[model samples]
Target: MASYECNRDFPVEIIPSSCARHSIKCRKIIVEKIRRDRISNSIEELRTLLQTNQTNQCPEQPSARLEKADILEMAVQFLREQASSKSNESYQSGFSHCLQETLRHLSLHAPLQPAEREQIKRFYVHQRTSMHTRLSTEPRAQFCMPSKRHSTLRVRKSLWRPW
Candidate 1:
């Protein structure tokens, strides 16, 4: 390909010879090597991560040499476990929050007696426990959020009170 070069004072035009094809091929090889190096380095990093996780989980067990496929499999398993635990934690937290809100609102506005409220609280606890046990036995659906995007919004509360 013909190309041009620009200096501070003037523009210079240049043309390529037949060796351009060889040069282009060499560049492609170099680029491919670099890409392969990146992939290998990332795999090594994952291997180390998996080793550390395994060691942490079982200190006395010796770590064996891992193949690339094994490393990838273990990494996938680890990620799934992490995601599942996070999801379960969020679900439990949300349920607890709902229970608290329900109790608070009932205390303020509901005409039910204290004994009835206590009975409802016991029912909530029972449901929470049963759901937790059920979830522990079954694989819950996973919903993944994009790690890169998050909101940090601040809202201004109105001064007017409904109460």
Candidate 2:
């Protein structure tokens, strides 16, 4: 493969231990204080959004150990909603930002299940195939003919060899 000739090596460097933790801690504490003052963006809010049956004023504490299965299921619904509402860019962006932030916080404290990796892979594939039609077509164009077979042919080609 001639892999050894490729530029894969890295130049090593050393740094003082204080350079890493202290600055990060200082920045985090500053942001953390501001967050305490704000009253928006809570896990309870997400649980409320995801739950269909529950009323707004539930007097129960949620389990801190949220299951990966539940999270993945909710994520599937969220992504589907985003993928379907392709006309609205702002809504999708806002939802994506919120989702990423929530996931970042959760991932720091919780470990994902072994099955979650496969779940994520499946989601990626689904989104890619389904969104290909919407994203590949030109936007802001005049009315065009709706040829069903044209789209299907492209999809089949992608499915066979996406290389």
Candidate 3:
């Protein structure tokens, strides 16, 4: 029986009697090399190429067609909570800005149907009244008082007198 060594590039020193073992090693090496080359290519470049192709594939904005009354109501509730807490001013400003942007987008792209708009208005009114009641009843609720400058503009004299 003539023992055959694997093809010239692989220094596979052991000469196997079966052809199956030799082919498996050769195929594995080829697959591994292809995988390594693929990994070496820049992923960012591939992403950019894909994005470029997709740039012209713009779909209509969801706000253009979908009724977003529920979404708007949720945003209003979130804003009210933030306002009541009186947390970081910058964060509150950013949140409000984003909410406004979303509303603007919805108005431009997906205007709500007349019925949906009415529902949204009703929901907002109900939410406001509920929040007011909760704030008044909750003992731990800390009401955010306006700054002294703002307060002074509304009143002629301090309500509390010095003892």
Tens digit of lDDT per residue, candidate 2, span 84-132? 4474456446645775676677677897676875675576567555655
TM-score for model 2?
0.26
Kindly provide the TM-score of model 3 when superposed on the true structure, using C-alpha atoms.
0.26
Write down the RMSD of candidate 3 (Cα, Å): 21.7
Who is ahead in TM-score, 1 or 3? 1
Ten-residue stretch with the least lDDT total in model 2: 138-147
lDDT of 1 by residue, 41-92 (tens): 9999999987886676556667778798878876776677578678777977
lDDT of 3 by residue, 1-163 (tens): 3434556554555545345676777789899999877754544344444334323332221222212343333334435645644643454466456755766787799987889777766765675565455444431221122134543542343122335
Task: Tell how far residue 29 is off in model 2, in angstroms.
Answer: 74
Each model's lDDT comes to 0.64, 0.48, 0.48
RMSD, one per candidate, in order: 12.9, 27.5, 21.7
Cα lDDT of candidate 1 equals: 0.64
